[model samples]
Every structure is written in C-alpha cells, then in structure tokens.
Target: MSTDAHPTPEGAQSGRGRAPDTEWRSWHARRLETITAPYGPLSLTGTHWLDDHPDGRIPAVPGVWVQDGEEIVLTAAAADGLTHDGELLSGSVRLTAHHGPIPESPLAHGDRRLVVLRREGLRAVRDFDPHAAARSAFQGIEATPYDPRWALPGRFRPYPEQLSVRVRSADGRERGLGLSGEVVFAYDGAERTLRAVVEGDGSLGIVFADATSGDTSYRFRFLRPFAPAADGTVTVDLNRALLPPCAFAGHFICPFPPPGNTLGFAVPAGERRLIGG
Candidate 1:
C-alpha cells in the first residue's frame, strides 16, 4: 500500500504521509496558527532566575516566591486569585518545577502562572500569561503539503551504547547532545541515515536538512517519527518534518544536527518556512 494509505486508526487519523487535497490545505492553515499562538515560542519575554531576586519576589508576578529545599514556596492571598492543586490556594504552597505537560501545571495566579524550572544547578520561574503579545501576534505555521515521496521506511541501528556529543548552541553556549542510534532509510532511490535522539516517550526526533535548507526553508528542520518496534525498525517520514523550538522561541536551547545528519539532496517537503518573515 502507498504511504498515504497508511491507514487511520480508530481515534486518530494516520499522521504519516500527505493528506488528501482538502485535508492537506486545512492542515497547512492550522499549522500556521499553532506556531504563531500567543504562548508560542516567539512571545517569551523573560526567564527570571530565583537567585536574581534574593528576596524571592519576582517583579510583575503577584506572589512571594522563595526556594525551600528542592521545592519552591509561593505565598499569595485570596485576592491574588492563585490556584494550586485544584484549589483556590491562599497563603502558601510548595511546588517543584513540573516536568510534565504545561496543561497540567498546578501553579497559577489569575492570568499569570508561575512555572518552576531548573537547568543545571540553577532554578528559575517561567511566567505564562494568556495576554502575552506573542500569543496575539501569532498567525500560523508555514508548511508544505504532505507528499508520500517524503515518507520512507527506515531501520534503526543502535550503537554500542548511549553516546553523548558536545555541540554549540545558537545562544553561543555548548551543551551535550545524546544519540541512541542512526535511522537508515531510502528516499528518491538514495539511501540516507540520520543520527537521532529517542524522546522519553519513545518518539524519534531527528535534526536534519537537505540541499533545500537555508534557501528554501530554514537552515534545518526537525523530523519526529513514531517509536520504533521491538525489532528496531521505524518510518523516517519526511512529510512530517518540523521546525525546532529555536525557530519559535529564542530562549530555547536547541541542538544543531551533527555533521552527518545533513542530506546531500534537496528534500523539499513538509514545513518550509514561516510566513511574513
């Protein structure tokens, strides 16, 4: 069967390959809206460190926040309209920077939510407001129509063990990039493979580019294939290639593709670039 006929399961449609003409255009329109959403990466105004405020009070955030051991203590009043653990919490509550999804976050103060964060040994708070200017300016994501030619079957070859390599960040910082293995696949009669990292949820995230990158699209695009099977085989579908967080939020520390991840041919499919520059 063709990749477009990959079959849509019961609840969710198959996210692989190109959508039919009607659905394909609709998906492209929605993609633009998602990338340009209010809380999207572009609107990040500040990332405040708790250490910066010795007194534990962040400016513009209506609460008294202090670090207590591994948790952060937030003190607010009923008038502050803060909610925590499903209750309109007043006084104080201890919180840890949530490692889970943003929708389930427990700490909120009216339109603003205090998101605890940790990087290295440093602790900080992320403030999310629905009224953020970025959210308002969002139009939508720019993506190319899904094409089966970009979808290809691939095999996963594991290394001896997990390997960590250092790469320079867009922010001029060096960080560790971990690799589990390489995903080898064929596209346009050419065999190609890319080094990828396995997400905690078992998805495969690859940073790559083709001859079209830097000219047709951004310097690089991201591809997230579903988790591999027990035998270590997965689909390296370029149809669903994506843009990195750095493309949205400047504060994000995104890793660059290693030397070998770049494909020599132009793979002109999926999200090409954002609109309006």
Candidate 2:
C-alpha cells in the first residue's frame, strides 16, 4: 500500500496538514478496495423500474416481474434457474419491496436475482447480473489513504424545519434532495459544514464536491456521517468517502449536489480517482 500523499490543488491548503495514523490509513485503503471490487457499487449494471415495463417482463431479465400495488408478482418456471434467498426458485411468489442489503435480497435465480423496489409509489426491479459488463471491466478505485487532518470532529445541527430541494440527477431526472441539518467541522482553521439529510435510521448523508471534482476524482462524491451521539457529536471521515451510483452505471438516477452542498474548497483527502487499467 502506498502511504504517500500526492498533492491535490483543489484541497491543497488542507492537504499540507499531517496525514492520519498508519493503522487508519490502511483501514481506509482496504475499505476502498472492497467498494471498488467486482460486486461493489461500481459493478451495478441497471436499476429497471417495473413501471417502465407495463407487461410484467423486463428486458434481458428472464423472469416475469410485475408490480401489483403493494407487492411484486414474480413468475418463474423451475427451468428458469433462479434463486431466492440463496435457494433455487421455480414457482410464482409474491414479493414485497426489499429495503435492506442487496446480497440478502429475497428473490434470486441462480446468480441472477429479481430485486423488488419502490420509490414514491413507482416500483422498480434491480437486476444484479454477476456477469454484468461493468463488473468485468472494473479494475479498481482511485482513492487517497486516511489523513487525520481530513477526519475532523463535527457537530450535527438539526434544522428547525426540514428542507427539500429538487435536483437534476445524472439520468436527467429530478429528485427531491431532503435536508434536515448540517454537519459543521473545521479544517486548517477554516470552518466548513455540509448540508445533510437524515436517513430512516438517523444517519446523515451529504452530497458534495471539491476542487478534485471533474479533475482528479469523480465529478461528485458522497459522505455518510454516522448517527450523532447524545451530545450531537459526530466524525466526518472523508477517508471513507464514496462514489455515487452514477459513477458505476449510467442508468442510475443519482441526484447532484444541492445548492451550498458543494464546498468551494478542494477535498484532497479521500478516494481520488478511478483506475481503469
């Protein structure tokens, strides 16, 4: 592993600080490797909504999939060679939308599973084909190792009223980017805060970019600030920053950074670029 810190003009001022500890740097590197792996977010091929196919059949996916308002009806013959929850499935099953991890999805056929999903009444099916082209073409992710200066202690301040903003996604669609508060921290004596949306589990998500955007790193990156403590203290660890869905497949409707979310500063501390070779 390379412990060296390369200069990034975007966040150059912040990069001049001391890097994080060796153990933390190694952990950050390994995390990047796992996220850029074959089955990582970069490997996602498509997010097919059931509403697009009025006929219960999704293109390229062999199972009969239809959403029946509240539940998804998937019809597959025993010979279709699909699996559900790791077991071979050959019959019709009524499946509800899964809101958990992809690997633990309740529907599958062999290596291909029909994932049922719903967003604001619009139903969709995510096809996780292990043989996806993106998965095969994945070389690795370009990232910066952890630096203590980049992992600043932050405070979560909830808004008096929740804020929602509609932003254009990479797929040319508009989606609501909700914000409940901001996580404020300081780097190089300069205070910075990110507009964050609280998740169902109370975790916070920030869609942001820095000088490295469209230059060294992907256009934009995502950062998840773990749930705040009783005292509202949190750690904004840029080392664990992530690439958005649009970074993997073009089909994803990932929203861009809302106003004020994009820091004018350059963040030169986390995942830096994409290694395609």
Candidate 3:
C-alpha cells in the first residue's frame, strides 16, 4: 500500500476521487460472496460441449443433450431426476443458450443448474453445483491495499471502427479479442496504454499483464474503468484490478492479454491469488 498522495492532475479530479479503504474492503467482501455463491464460477464442475460428446450423454449429468439447429434438445427420463420450473421433466425440452444469470436457468438437477452456453456456434452445458470441491475448500483472495499511485487519469480513444485480435484463452484455445478503443494514461512518469473492450453496460474492460504478473500476482488481471465522460476522460484505477474467472475455475475460458496490453511497470495493488487452499 502506497501512502504518498501523488498530485492529481488538473481537470482529472473533477468527477473522480480515490476510494476510501473502507469502501475497497467492502467491495472485496462482496466480490468474495459473489464468487462463492451457489451458482458462481467456483461452483462450475464441468463444461461439456455437445460437439465433443456425439453420444449425447454427458458425464455425471443425467440427460441426453443434442444440438438441434440453434437450440439444444435435452431429453430426460423421469428417473433422471431432472426438473424444469420445479416440475420433473418426463419428456424433452428445447433449450437455447441462457442469456441470464445461472440461478435463472430453467434446467436444474437438485441444486445444480444445467446452463446451456454457446461459444462461436459451438454449444455446451455447464454444470454448477453448490457442493463442488472448489467451493467447499474455499479460500479468500489475496490483494494489496489501496494505493493512490495506481489510480491515474486516462483518456479513451475509440477506434473509428471496432477491431479484433487473435489471442489465446486460458483453455489454450485461440479466439478473437474484440477491441473498441484504447485507454491512454501516464504511469511511472511515462505514457502507457491498453486496448479496451466496451462492455455491455458501457464500462471499459481491459485484460492486462504487468511486471508483477506471475510473481507477486496472477499472470493476468482485469480492470474495468467506468464509462468515459463526453470529453473521453476516465479514471484508470488499477487498485481494483481483478483476477479473471479462470483464476477461480478451470472450466471458464477466459481470454489472455492481447498484444501491447502488458505493462512494463510493476503494479503491486489489487487482487493477487486465492488464499489458503
């Protein structure tokens, strides 16, 4: 944690202020609760792709899942103990990729949610169970305390058109990383930038690596700056850097850092790794 308050540049202090330590601690607690929730990432036990299992029978999950055009056709017997909307499913139900939260998923087996997920035209089913070993052996996250130096003023420069770059995911599969803009800021007396994606809620999402990566922190972390002002000014707060979902579960396919998103300087703030086990 840095105690020195570096001078906040003019015009940058207008709508942004360093968050109090209490607030950051509260946020961290909430994050822990979210990730450990019943249907959170940590509860994901398996992701079975329909294409990979041509037999339609998924391991552990008691259903025959087959891709039927854009939707997934799930056939279940009463003995399978599968339910949809609290009623035991006796026949079949056509399921499309759930665009909502895991708990809202229509398919359930006891307390587990069988969520249909689609990635690049490939469909899959994710089994989330509250009793997953990863959730049971739960540990807290390790993070550095709030540091004002990691909070810098930045400007968003949107590209004339959206662009994408090929990057490898945590699953070792290459995928396209879409970029909507670049966030330019000053760090360590030098100008630096990161390619950013505009999230659905209009926030800026960035996946980056810093000098501390793979040493004191995870190999990569995520940063989400609030939407930029009309003048393109935004606060780049690295103190809120986050571990990608893959850090919590291997089933998640989180994208790796794209080109030029790796910083040369060490950032000792934000979430590092899971504590305990």
Candidate 4:
C-alpha cells in the first residue's frame, strides 16, 4: 500500500501565518470520505444520454426516460423495483435537470441511483451503484506533503465582460466553459497567471496543468481560491489542489483547462494519482 506521512506545511503562509496542519489533515480525511461514499464519483458506472437511445430504453437501466420539452419524463413500472422518496413508483414522474447531489436523485433501484440530468439542452441519466467495481478497487490517493511555495497570494482581475470558451470534455465532446477573469501570482520569480471560473459561491476556480501533469499527477488539477477580499486579494493555495472528478470516474465530463492555464514549471506538491487498482 502506498502511504504518505501526510506532513503539514509548516510555513505555508497566506497572510495568515503558518497553515494549520490539523485543519488540513481533517479536510483531507473528509475529502477521502466524501469521494468514496456511496453514490460518490467512484460509484458512477454509466452516463447514458437520452438522445443516443431513441426508444427510451437504456441498457441496464429500468425505465423509459424521454425528453419532453425542458423536462424529462421517467415512466417506471413496479416490476422495475424503482422507488422515489422511499415509496415504490409504478407510473411516470416529470423530472427536470438534477442540480443537487447524487444521493438525492429522484429515482432509485434498491441502493442504486438513476440520476436524470440536463446539460446544454441535452438530457441523460447517470447510474450510480455502490457495488461498482471502481469503488471496490479504490485503494488511496497519492499526494505530496503541503509546501508554502505553492500557496501564494494572488490577485483576481475580472474581465470587463464574462466570456465563454468551448473546450473538450473528458468525454471528448466540446462544451462551453465560462470564464470570469484571471488570477495572477508569482512563480519562479516571474508573474504567472491562470484564467478563473466563478463558482456558484463566487469563489474563483482554477483548472490547470503543470509539468508534472500526465506523468506524476493527473492530467489536470483544480484549485479553488475563495472570493477575493475588498481589494481583490485571494490566496492561491495549490497545496489544497484537487484531482478532477474525471480522475475518479470515467463517466464524468470534466473539461480541459482553458488556454494558457498550463504552468511552465513543475509543481511537485498536491494530489498526484490513484494508488491501487
């Protein structure tokens, strides 16, 4: 089994002095728990698009899911053993896009969730089973100890107008990824910048790749710097950088980093790769 001492970054300064080791360790533990939880990323087995199956019959998924205007109509039979809200559903239910967590999905067969979703006017259903092989085979995530050099002060420079760029998703389809602005910081004694996406909570989300990408680390990683202060100052803590959802599940359609988001230098800190088969 691969193991890291999980040492704390003693001098990871962000104008808040040293980064708290215990807090980071606790966050790491919770992250592990969240990813391996039932119906989490590892449990996602398939994402079947409704358009791909004109007959509304998806393999291994018991139900007829068809797009009717902006809503999805899911017709289920009692024989399918489908339930909604803890009650057996024997008829149809109008389901719109699911914007919440997977566990709260509207339809289920025993412990498996049939999550209906829509993206860019396309509809689909994701089947998440706790007994998925990926979940059972997951061992651990290889990560490097935190280092202060990766956690630096950065400035968010918002664009005069928000922009959307089409990028290739992990599923090899093109999708629009909205960009709010850019975050600039110093690395290798030179100014480095990355385009930022404003998350639902107004925090700045950075999708980036580095020299270590495709080798030591995953193809890409994510860093979320909280909403800037009054002066547009935010801490770019790569120590807390996260592996993308696609890293854990093949069904996820994680987008590639926007143009110029790849750093030129190697960043040896943060999550690297999956540990076991």
Candidate 5:
C-alpha cells in the first residue's frame, strides 16, 4: 500500500465507525491475558550475552555456553539437571537461535526455558520461568479509558526506499531501526507524521512518545497498525497504543522511539505502565 499525493479525509461515521466501549474493554482484557501468560515477557528473568562471559559460565544458570560461529555450544553434566525435549542431557549439543514461540525452546532447566536469541551479530540466552518475581508481582496494566477521539483516519506514505537509522535503545545501547515509510494523519487541526517500520507480517510498527510521556504515561509507547489498504488508507488508533516489552520486564532490550517520532502534543490514551510498578 502506498500513500497518494493528496491526503484523504475519512468520514467519522463511515465504514470504520467508532468502536464500542465493550469492544475496547474486551481488547484490554485480552492484552492482560497475553502479558501475564506463563512464558510472556513478565516471566523473563535474565538475558545473558555470551560475550559478557568469556569463561563460558553464565551467572545463576548451570551448564557452560560458548559461541561457536553461527551456533552456540552448550556443555552440561547430568548433575546440572538440564534436559532437551524432556530427556536428560549429560553431554554437549550445538544449537541455533530459536525463531518461534518461547514454549518451543529446546533446552529446559526444570520449569525454565533457556531460549537462544541473536540480535545484530551478538548471541544471548534468555531465561524464562513461570514463577518469576515480576510475573508474580504483576498487578495489571495501567491504561486510559478508551475514547473515540483517540482513533483517527490516516494514510501511509512509503519512502522511495527503505532507510535505517541508529537509535538508542531502552537498554542504553544503540541499534539500527529500519524504516520503510511514514504514517500521516490529522490531529488537533494539524497534520502529523510518524516514521514507521514494516513488520515481518506486513504491518507497520511505530515507537513514539508525546508530551504526556514521562509524566502521565511511560517514557515511550508502541503502536502497530494493520497492513494498509491498496490506497494506503488505515486507522491510526491511539487508544490501542501499547507499552513496550521493557515496561513489563527490565531484561527485555526494547528499542526507543526514533528521531522525529516523538510528538509535541499529549496523547492520554492506551497503556501507561505496569500497575503498582
């Protein structure tokens, strides 16, 4: 989908009418179920990078993990109590980073899944346990009551080509953020635009902040719009804005908003923070 040269205004009571309060409530309830799930972000306990431990011993985790080219070599003893696919593992095995759901990870230490992850060129292992402290202490997600005014019609304008910008991440590290286009919409009588990245599923992922950030809400939030129509028409719904994964757990390395993605106005909608935390 590509944006047209001229912006198009969608009627307030057109095909995409205001969503009912019950629908928004249901969405919020589902969000809670997802985040508090057993292997969700809240269950993550550690992100152990191999480079940080040259001795091949990960802190607090049994077994030795060493980076071997594009794969990782894990050496364990029977006493380590590590298993692979429910079988006890007492030797060495090579493993590649997992690309699917966390429950599908191969290595497990009791109830914890040792998930391999590769970011940029660095390799790391994430430990996820259902009984993690964060998961246990999770009260709920703080969000504003849904309002129709926060939902606006928008158009997606693709760039001539893809572009990558280096931005600071929540972990205090810099990483590349690939941008494919911008989503433009009218708000408060003015047109606004946000640089967005095309997700693997063809949706648009946006990380943004507003005047309410760091005050009434989190420092930044994320929004993912469905694939645009052939005419680049889409709904820019601020009421569905979400807190990044880092907001649920400190171990997650979520990226921050790219340059110019921060808005000058306040957006009092969507998720604010983890309740009581």
Candidate 6:
C-alpha cells in the first residue's frame, strides 16, 4: 500500500514451464479467494474523504477524523466502540498517512477495519467490514479462460523523466497519476501503446479500457506487467489482466484510463466482471 495512496492488487505467479491452463485456473481460484476475504475489495463499504466533511463525522462510520497539517486526528470516544493496536482506544490519537492490509492498520471497529489514507495532501478513511453485502453475495469473477492469442509480446520504453498528470478518479475527483513510460506492441497487425506507471516493486501498472469496456467488461481494467527484462523486452499478457478495485466496490476511487490508454479494439479475454452481475 502507499503511505500517501492506496495500493492495487495481488495475484499468483507460476513457474515458466507450468501449463498455461492449469496455472491460470490456480491463479483464478486464488483471486476469488482473495477478493472474498474479510478485508478484501468486496468488503470495502466506503472511502470518506475528510475534506468532504469539515465536521469530521463520516457517514455510517464511527469516529471523528480531522486532518491537521501532516497528520489525521482521530478522536474515538469509548462509546465509539473503536480500538487502536488491539487495545480499547479512548480520547484522541494522531495518525500518520498509510493504507495497506487491514490487519496492519492500527484502527478497527469490531470486525471492520478503518484504513486511514492520505493522497495528494488529501485525507480519507476507508471502511472495510467483513460483513459487507458485496462480499457475502460474491460468487466469483467472470473471466475468460486462458487463451494463447490474448497474450502478446511488447517492449517497455522508459521515459527520461517520470511525469504526473491529473486524471479523474472513480470518486469524481481529479488526482495526479504518475506516468513513467509507455508499453508499445503489435495487436492484430496494429501498433498500440499504453501509458505505464512504475509500481513500488519496479513492475509496470497499466490502467486501461478497450472496446469491450462498459459493455462486456468493466469500464477499465488493470494489467500488471512484470519488471522488464534487462533488454527491455516483456510480455504484455492480457490473459492475466485484472478488474480494478472499483469493479468490486463503488467506494473505491480507482483512477480511470489516462489519455491514450484506451485500446480501440475489443479485448474479450481477461477478467470481465464480477459474478452475479
């Protein structure tokens, strides 16, 4: 997770020689398990930006969260039924900006985790409750089975300097999304490019859309490309493309595709939508 922003996702890796179908099945099953977990994306109920509520009272959430310069002041009285680091918390506590695994977060209300996050100098609190309706009703993600044709080869061209561009988020607010380079490749006899961002682990993150978006698939999806090889050659495997967090929960402010990140053709492979529509 980002100290100043929320992180993306997790997936399983396979050995180089593993059968594609078997590996894909394993990966898909794990993905389902992860999303249905206690604090997974489907369990997220809300992300209340503190700036939206000057009084520090977030809807359906307990605690008074106010931003003070570089920190978030969370005043949870005994009646709030909140805890910090496992002990019942009373009075007020100052919190630093961080968003990661729910268990690692310092604040909680019973089975729900209160994730304090700060992005671009803005603060927010994400509520992750195990009993969220979406998680309980989740059947699985509707993904196309592994198909060799959907996996394409590409080359990573890094920029001389990283740049940040403001893009609209799912929450209807514009936030700066860092773009470090582009992934160029041939798809169906046409050359295409996707804006790429450098992830914390040195991998490339692609948030994009295609013709199928908003019709067959979610509005946008994420493709996590492994760190480039020394020669800059990499595989732009769409078979492993993932549905962004916002697909599971509306509260997630997942960023939309940056300019030029939308593919013109339909991409029928990869995760389409969550089960049960």
State which candidate has the highest lDDT: 6
Query: What stretches of model 1 exceed 4 Å from their correct place?
Result: 1-44, 51-55, 75-82, 86-90, 187-190
Stretches off by above 4 angstroms in model 3 are 1-19
Per-residue lDDT of model 5, residues 71-136, tens digit only:
999999999999998889899999898866778898999999998888788899999999999988
Displacement of residue 159 (Cα, Å) in model 2 is: 1.3
TM-score to native of every candidate shown = 0.76, 0.81, 0.92, 0.91, 0.92, 0.94
Give the higher-lDDT candidate: 2 or 5: 5
lDDT of 2 by residue, 143-193 (tens): 776666677799999999998888777767776777889999887778888
Model 5 is weakest, by summed lDDT over 10 consecutive residues, at 2-11
Report the C-alpha lDDT of model 6 over 2-98, residue by residue, as the tens digit: 4112234555243457887787788788778778888888888988889989999987888888899989988888988999999888999999866
Error (Å) of candidate 3 at residue 172 is 1.1
User: How badly does each model clash, as a count of residue pairs?
Assistant: 6, 10, 0, 0, 0, 0
In model 4, the Cα lDDT at residue 32 comes to: 83
Question: Which regions of candidate 5 deviate over 4 angstroms?
Answer: 1-19
Q: Residue by residue across 31-87, what tens digits does model 4's lDDT show?
A: 788778887788989989999999999988998888999998889899989998888
Tens-place lDDT per residue, model 1, 111-186, is 5656688755567787666677666665555677777666688998888898877766655666677788899998
lDDT, ranked from best to worst:
6, 5, 3, 4, 2, 1
Q: Which pairs of residues collide in candidate 2?
A: 10-266, 20-147, 20-148, 82-109, 82-110, 83-108, 83-109, 83-110, 143-271, 143-272
Error of 4 at 200 (Å): 1.7
Worst lDDT 10-window in candidate 3: 1-10
